[model samples]
Target: AGGISEALITTAAGLSVAIPSLMFYRFFRRRVDELVLNMEEESLKLVEVIHGEREPDRTSEAA
Candidate 1:
């Protein structure tokens, strides 16, 4: 019985921090991945426009 309750309390406290820490880590990791993918797509589009492989969008010019 020695230190049984204390050990459990410590374990629970560790999980309280660890669970949310892991969740936030995954959340931000996914967010960063999405952003990087978007940036890559946008950069490809820009490269196409710069190299005359694709026509430039003219909506902003008309606006």
Candidate 2:
């Protein structure tokens, strides 16, 4: 009886820690994905500029 009670207590404790840790891990993973996408976009723009594939807008330059 005592062994079963101890097992149950440990199981509950482990889940309490695991659930929140998993949630935080997922949240940060999504944030990292967004950051990576933004970096890729900026890098592509830089590459375009370097190759002269994209022209700078005259209106933006005037501003």
The best candidate by TM-score is: 2
Off by over 4 Å in 2: 56-63
| CA lDDT of every candidate | 0.94, 0.90
Candidate 1 per-residue lDDT over residues 1-63, each given as its tens digit: 769999999999999999999999999999999999999998998899999999987775754
Q: Assess the local accuracy of residue 34 in candidate 1 as a C-alpha lDDT between 0 and 100.
A: 100
As a TM-score, model 1 comes out at: 0.84
Off by over 4 Å in 1: 59-63
Q: What is the lDDT of candidate 1?
A: 0.94
Least accurate stretch of 10 residues (summed lDDT) in model 2? 54-63
Q: How close is candidate 2 to the true structure, as a TM-score?
A: 0.85
